[model samples]
Target chain A: MAGIGDRISGTFFLVLGLTMYLFVNPNYIESVNGGNISPNTFPNILSIIIAVCGTMLLFKPTTQQAPDLRSVAITSMYVLLLVVGLYAMSKFGFEYVAPVLAFVIMIAIGERRLHWLLLGIVGMPVLIWLLVTIVLGRALP
Target chain B: MVELDTILAGFADAFTLYNLSFVLFGVVLGQFVGAVPGIGPIMAMAIAIPFTFGLDTLPAIAFLVGVNKGGLVGGAVPAILMNTPGTPDAAATALDGYPLAKQGKPLKATKMALFSSITGDTVSDIVLITVSAPLAILALKMGPIEIVALMIFAFSVLAGLIGNSLIKGIIAAALGLLVACVGQDPEHFTPRLIFGHWDLFNGLPLPSVAIGMLAISEMLRRMSMAHGNKVSSAIINLDTGNPNDQRVTWSEYWSCRFTLIRGATIGTILGALPGIGSTAAAFMSYAMAKGTSKEPASFGKGNIQGIAASESANSAVVGANLIPLLTLGIPGSVGAALIISAFMIHGLQPGPLLFTNQGQLVYGLFGAMLMANFINLWVGQIGLRFWVKVVSAPESIIFSSAILLCIVGVSMATSGIFGVAIMLIFAAIGYVMSSFGYSLVIFIIAFFLGPRFEKSISQSLALTNGDLAQILKSPVAVALLILSVISFVWFMRKNNQVNKADA
Candidate 1:
């Protein structure tokens, strides 16, 4: 039997294909070659391909390496951290938020070494800040 | 006929101190990352694209090319010393390299790899310099119908040849095409999927999409692993006091000349075709070497020819990959895709017209590519020791710092936070796609080619009034379409047989 990922992706593709086909308004598809083809024509064809692929996977699924829950959790944590970090950087300046964010990310990735942690937290931000602000003359955040 | 004066003028342009310094810097940086496991050249280039925004077109490309070429040389370092390949392309190098290191001949293995790699790269670059112009000129004859058929053929070859499953690869490619359709319809410029957000009219930023998928996704994957990059394999001791063990005598180096030539030839051929990557080339060359050898069993047990075969072929792919990119605007590998994106970013389109219109720029790039090969050799010889030390850095700090750098890069390239948001979203999508066994490389290649493909299709439709029968009239187009069908079927059978064998 196929894994949960295969099933989920299969369903996702089926839904996506159906939505694209059903929702692409005719007004948006400019007709060309006396309406023999349009911009929507390719997407319509792609939608069919997408649907067939989904149906094929449903019936004849291939083996996929199942991702672990812990990995998912870790990825989620990083995403959450980035979202919050982006929010935080928007509120505060990048210089203020960057070091703290860098430090947290390092900890999240299992970096417990003191010097390495220090370098990542302090060295990374300073280097990036100097490069962006001073060298490249680009704004941050 | 190829002009000598233009070529020499290009050499003069590349000889400038500004360009050469960036190339040197790029090679050094490439070696640094390539020594470390997990952070390969593709990830580095994706992240570094934004840094080139402030530089000129020539220096910017020179830097990235140098990084790419340098990474190949540096990848062999950890493969020889630690038995862990620094890049996917170098995985086969560790087969013989690590064993030789265990025999207290790490230097000999590394040096031979360096020499053979330079030889292969040089050979491919010469081929690229000579043939790409004529090829591009030939490509000029292809009409919209032929271009449409050619791209379909490329996609077919790519879908079947890349990744584990053809179905999954197709799904990924289809998804990429869908995502690419988000901004506007290519023919009439009608909005298709932009959800009334005016900011999205320009489409998702390339740097954002690319870096997010390639770089952040990789870092996320590493962080998700059990031991992650922290699994420190035992590093083989490098300096044995014996001088004979450290040196590759002239006879030993000369012995692998034919093996080097064969590997280079294989790599060059494979690299010319879209999507047969250096990893495949390296393994293919290694297989060919072992298959043709008198002592096949000696392969995994520290064969010098094995190292020569793997390194030469993989490195040769770098130069040969540009053949299709420069000639036909089709990238042969992920690395070449990045290079094409870089070219596009610099306001230069890489097609047949690029050769005809921007002849000087094209020649200068060629000169720079040739220059990168020599610099890669020199830098590899000196920096091998430095990179060996860099290999020991813990992956935790590296990944953490790298994620921050990626945000910086994307924001700079796209001019603000909007692009960063796009990157974040794509990063999540990339993680899901990767976890689901979809090919990220295929998705990216498809995404990059989608606009061109749609345009060509639109043109073909206009030309033939959407008549399928008309496409059959063009012999070249019909031949390509048939080849695509044949290739797909052949690969399907091959994949099934392999799966059955495994089962």
Candidate 2:
């Protein structure tokens, strides 16, 4: 799994570095005191270094234990839920959406206890709001 | 000479009721988080940074320092009790600590660990207080060329000393530099890679990137682990009723004094150097103690010196790691990096000017560190039982709430939803890099140092008119560049040897 991951990352970085070198604008109206190094010099140098390193990584692969697929799937679902909840909060308001998001994430992660679920669903957002608005005197999103 | 007036004033400031209370609070929270497996000090510090927004600068910094110091002592508890180290830095402690616990002397092992930790931390803090000012003064003499050379040396040391692959470390660092170029060009004030987004004009928010990569990504990774639900059922049976088993004799402690001193020294030196982390310091000290022991074979079989060595070294790193951060504006550890960001948030730039410009605050921070060591020792004794229970809390609750906090914290800091989205994006990127065995430490440090590096490079180029020969004219810069080359070669050689041994 690590080997495959490295291969993909290597290729991605390699392509990204080459594209940046080829396409990114290196032109500046004026350089720093007319020195040879431009704003693009640093990034261009870094891109070259990255491309070379990526190439080396691709050539000499290392072995590592594979990650669990079930865990990955669960983690992906949690991320998806987070994105959806954030979107919902943007459309609606945090007061309405935060509790439901917390409750849904708890359930998604296998929390089934009644009191814990209740606390997560209702109590968590209230506590956070109080801490933000009351204690810190900062308005919540 | 040290400024006695400033030192006294700093003590006066740090001993205030509010500061002390926050210090106590930080220690308690740090102990709880550190004693829980999968929640290390770095994560705790990163998560705590946003909360510090509400605090005064001195108290906020003191609070975070208290957390870091408390974590060093707290991590030893589970290592002694269940043979499961709460943090990686305490893994060496388990070799002798668990054995001692199994001998029905858990209290003795824990007490010894606590004593050694406090002793080492105090010594290292004293060293930091004394050494940092002089280092900063020396740094003030450096020109842009010297500063650039110094940064290069730091990068070489970091990439060489950390992680399995130097190439991967470099790649991570390069990626970080690229990411740091997202907003505006430092010199030209033109958009470099904004891609038409005005948010990118100010660059990615530091808090968002830091919290996402260091805290959120790790939380997600832990949530995905197969054994994420398997909380340890084993408990420490502290034979508190038995005096002989519960207490470390004065004689016994005196006998291990040399070992404690050696471990603390090793930890201080290594911790001050960028990229040599506490885990390495602890194991190195442990090995040194074992190698020098008269009964070497008995070293790992419940030897008190083993616990002393490991605990002292790891704890010492908490203070010593600040040496680079306070003096050079280079963070020597993940915790130090987070602290740097906090320093920035408080509008105090780290580096040489900090000592000259903010001498009172610097001394106050030193005083706060010394206070935190004592607080850590006192709190660890009273809160041991409470922390043990905290370790058993359900992962679902802790991580789920933490995720919410991450989101809310970013939103509150940025006053918009965009920062949270940036956090989520970086968290995904961090997770991918970590899974592929890239060094996130290198990446984050490089990113943090990126703008400074670019500025220094440009300044040096302008000063020297891009003349390669002019580099050799500055003795300090030449010496630093030479050291960088030597470190790079040594690191590659060491890595090659390790690879061959593994093969």
Candidate 3:
């Protein structure tokens, strides 16, 4: 399973590197005295290196230590759910969704008490707002 | 005369109210983060990086230096109380610390750790101040070729230091460099590898990368272990109900004084060297102490002396690592990188010329390093009990909070949705790597050197007109290259031997 994960990730990088080379061609600002190297040169070099490295990973595969699959699946699901909540809240405003999301995560992670969840669920956004608006004075989307 | 005056000026700058405040705050916060399990000094440094954008460089650095010193002491809190070490460096502390706690003497063990940490760190800081400038001066005389060679030496050393599997370590490092390439090229000012996103223009933000690779990945790993077992919270006897409990005696301190000193010395030397980290120093020192000790069995079983040796040595490295960073521009550790960032932000360049040109900044940084040890000693002593409680917070709660904080921290930096996406992707990758027993050290350090390596190689090639021999022309470059080769070969041989034995 772990080997498959590495192979999949490695192959994805190879494909991504190819795509980056194909799609991204940054136009550089040319100078009067001497035209410098374009922005694309570095990335193109990077793409080739990445692709090569990824392909090499395919051949000389190291044995991967197995993970506790159930735990990983649960945690990943929780993270996925949270990410979805964040994206959904982006529509209704983060102020509305962030606190609830934090609360759900806390509960999911074993905060069994309802009072603690309610307090955290409500208190977290207010705290974040105070930190951003009153202290740092940065606008949070 | 100028050197003497420079030292005086540094002291003057460091003694100021603002610098003192920054140092104090950094120390306090560092200790807080350190005491918490799974959050090391590097993570604290990463999280603090974004906040420094608002401050002047000197104060910004003073804070980070304090944190570095304080982090060494902070990890000992959990190691002593809960048997769960906050940082890898504190793993040695756990050997003796948990036994002490089990014996109903956690407070004494904790206090001994505090005292030894202070003593070792103070001594190392003094030594660092004496030696760092001369080394930096030597480094500054070297040309671009030597610099590139030095960087390669550092990278190779870092890779070798990580774990048993050399190729796996290299792969992780390569992955880091790849991620680092996501940002715009510094030399040409052209965006590289940013797939139609303006956010990628700046590259994967360092803090986001850090929070993901170190903080979030750790949280996930911890959560996996924690879900299977109930977090055993046996309230150990802190008050020492038994009056006969063996408190840390003056005689014990005197006997272990040499061990503490030796450990500190080892830590200081290791910390000064790039890639050899505090954890390595701690283990090396612990082994040395045990090897030389008359009572070797006393170690790994509630020996206050063992705790003292490990804690002090590891803590001392915090001060020693800064020696190279301040005097020379080269970062000796992740913590030093934060200080370097602070310097860059404040419009001060680190190196031999920095000491000559920005004498006050050098002096100020040095002074802050010294003062932070005292601050850590004072602050850590007072906050001992509170820190223990903080350390023993349920692993589940801790991991959850870490994940939440990582998400929030990343979001805070971008202010948009992009960083969140980046965090998830990196977190998944990090989790996958962790599952495979792959070390993230390579990834983190590779990410650190990526831009510099690219710039140095290109610039060196430009100067030599693509003559690769330029790397070997300079004696310094040649020496560093040889050292890298020797180290790389040694690591590969060792890895093969270990694998054969395992098989």
Candidate 4:
């Protein structure tokens, strides 16, 4: 009865655990024969536990809610835009990218009102800039 | 003895106009965010934490405490009016609240919830102020082995109780532990999991992780919903202006006195314990109140006592949860965990030593908590109409603005866009984990405590010369280990029973 989400998550964890166990380094120079309780010990233990949990999840017959693909798609698109926006910020500075990101996100989320959109695009970035630069005295990225 | 004078001085500090304004502002903001359906207090607190960097420790902590307290009262509003609890802890309130609202007494139900919340919260704060000092004093005597054993017990309790599946909870905790180990090895001062990224030498910034998992992931989840603004349709009409239906008489309040007292006591006790969250406390109190009621069948049919039981218990949890955080350095709830991060950001380590090292600030925080209770009551009464309007505002705007705020806050705190990138990564992880039913609370808490766990175990190993037999020499550590084993077995048995029943 395990749903697609559980199966997918199980496979993910299993792969991740195995990869970390096989590849990650956990030793330091000060340890005795890589130390009985070296840094790797905890991570190794955790990896084993996760791998076991993943195996159990794969085999366990339990009900799970199905993932919403449509919502996932929309959220992915939003995240993609966000990443792009961050890149743009790096290129053109926060002041330029902030309002544009806000405007695009508001529209994407279905905000149709012009005034609200304007407020978000124009007002939010300026307010945040003032708060960061003047009040907190922190440099904007 | 000195604690008394520190407390008085704290009261004086908290009463200043500058500090009081922050408390008021925090409560107001908490109520607004709590009244909103998709956003909750934890997210609000996360977004607000970066703002506290500029303020002194007292005002900053006071502001955050006010937000946490205000959220307790504000959550009840949506439960009473719309039958949609704003926070998970307030879900039990809707059982009786919606029915009461339907009987044309929405105002009455909201007022009852508010009064009971304030009363419960104040009493819990009193318990916290009184109990935390003694507990911290006791904790000061604990060795590394005892601390290690105690953390194991906490992990077991959290993994066992917080989420539906114990296996998933443990898996989440394991993931958290792995993530926590990404920084330098505490003992050797060498990098453990930092993959050639100098920025990660300090490990994953806490503010980024917190904002990502709690706030950004939540926004992503809400965005993914088909009916994006469905909560807007659940708004109730509270403008009836009927004086008779609006006010709760003294006799009515007195009638539910026993229920409120019992609920508060239950919440206080449960909140002080690790892993038993406010939601459980509220439901447990509601069940007990119903079982003891003269008319049990009226429980879900507009019974005021039902509202009293749920509200009092949940609100009581807000203050009582701080007990373990301040005393043992273990966060008893997600809110407490976030507060712990704030403490770290402020350069104040929370635990037994906090009382001795920073007694003035600790007592100041206590005074602030007391003041927050009064602020919650006063602000909640005057701002009800304003909050109703706020809740109805477009979700797109709120969430979009939230995105902007997250970027601003993270960028400001880390002074770089790198934190934003880290936040997005964790947000994706959090979204996936939550969608699959893993407990984010357990994950975040484990992450927070992971370093401490490693330090304690390493210290204990050094002390014991890697001999397990030496750990048994400490009676306190032995007792704690036994208790941890018992808790693990009990929770496993309980989980199996639940699975069997489900099957």
Please write out the lDDT profile of model 4 over residues B163-275, one tens digit for every residue.
Answer: 77777878998999889988776776667777777798777899999999999999988876623342244556775778868877899999999999999999999999988
The stretch of ten residues in a row with the least summed lDDT in candidate 2 chain B is B226-235
Q: Model 1, range B1-503, lDDT digits (tens) per residue?
A: 34677767877888888889999998888888988888988999999998998888888998999889888988888888888899988989999999998998988888888888888899899999889989998899999999988988988888888876787788888888877877778877766777776677877679999999999988877877723344443455778999988777899989888899999998999999998989999999999999999999999999999999999999999999999999999887889989999998989988898877777778888888888888888888887777878888888778877888898888889887778888988899999889988889889988888888888887888888878799988999999999989988988787677656654
Report the C-alpha lDDT of model 2 over B281-397, residue by residue, as the tens digit.
999999999999999999878999999999999989988999999888999888898889889889888998888777878888888888898888889888876776666666666
Give interface RMSD, per candidate.
2.8, 3.2, 4.3, 2.9
The list of candidate 4 runs beyond 4 A from truth reads A1-4, A26-36, B226-235
Q: Of the candidates numbered 1 and 2, which has the greater DockQ value?
A: 1
Q: Give the local distance difference test score of model 2.
A: 0.83
DockQ value of candidate 4: 0.50
DockQ of 1: 0.54
Query: Residue B500, candidate 4: how far off, in angstroms?
Result: 2.8
lDDT of 4 by residue, A13-126 (tens): 888888777776433222334443676778888988898888787676345565777877887887898899989988898888888888887777777778778878887788
lDDT of 3 at A112: 63
For model 4 chain B, the run of ten residues with the poorest summed lDDT: B226-235
TM-scores for all candidates: the values are 0.96, 0.95, 0.89, 0.96
DockQ comparisons of all candidates to the true complex: 0.54, 0.48, 0.33, 0.50
Better of 2 and 4 by lDDT: 4
Off by over 4 Å in 1: A1-4, A24-37, B1-3, B226-236
The residue pairs found clashing in candidate 1 are none
Q: At residue A95, give the lDDT of candidate 1.
A: 86
Candidate 1: residue A135 Cα off by (Å) = 1.3
